[model samples]
Target: QVKYLNNIVEQDHRRVRQRTRSMLGFKTFMSAAKTIAGIEMMAMIKKGQLNIPGSTPFEQFYALAG
Candidate 1:
């Protein structure tokens, strides 16, 4: 049962795992944090998880950044 539950949790993070795997790793904690934050933001936008108004994902990301 615990293994099943863990699989569910791992599936949720699959996208993040795939993204980070290609980066080859980070050199600093701050850079890793920033890069992960951006990755999460893009993932959220792609998943329609945020309600920010914008015609495109880039605009929505800009609105959030600005």
Candidate 2:
């Protein structure tokens, strides 16, 4: 279990570095970190067809789907 955990961390570290490597180093590290966090989040969201919350106006959505 410890070895498996290390592997997960290793992969995540490589991916995060790769992502930030393309970005311009910001004036402040905290600013850069927040921007990277937001970009990563948005990238995850863009990866697939996201399910919108079911709380939408269902009649309109149903009509649109039809």
Candidate 3:
């Protein structure tokens, strides 16, 4: 669990910076960190570790949450 958590945290931060480079530069580091974590969840779905149902691109993972 620590590995997953740490990976998410690091990747999230990286993605947030990538976003900033494109547009919407964050004014605060803390705020960007939180937002990054949220977006990271979606990005990590590419790993397909949860085995979500259906054949959707990423929406199937959302289905498994229910």
- Candidate No. with top TM-score: 1
lDDT of 2 by residue, 1-66 (tens): 485898876664565678779877789988887766655544434443333555344443344345
Q: Taking the tens digit of each residue's C-alpha lDDT, what string does model 1 give over 31-57?
A: 999887887888888989986764699
Compare candidates 1 and 2 on TM-score and give the better one.
1
If the candidates were sorted by their TM-score against the true structure, best first, what order would they fall in? 1, 2, 3
* Alpha-carbon RMSD, each predicted model: 2.5, 8.9, 5.8
Give the Cα-based TM-score of candidate 1 against the true structure. 0.74
Clashing pairs for predicted structure model 2, backbone only: none
Q: What are the clash counts of all predictions, listed in order? A: 0, 0, 0
Regions more than 4 Å wrong, model 3: 1-13, 26-35, 61-66
TM-score for all models, in order of appearance: 0.74, 0.45, 0.40
Model 1 misses residue 26 by how many Å? 0.6
What is candidate 3's lDDT per residue for 1-66, written digit by digit as tens?
Answer: 475898867765686567667766778998877666656665557656445566664575456443
Give stretches of model 2 more than 4 Å off. 43-66
In candidate 1, the residue pairs with backbone N, CA or C atoms under 3 Å apart (3 or more residues apart, or in different chains) clash, namely: none
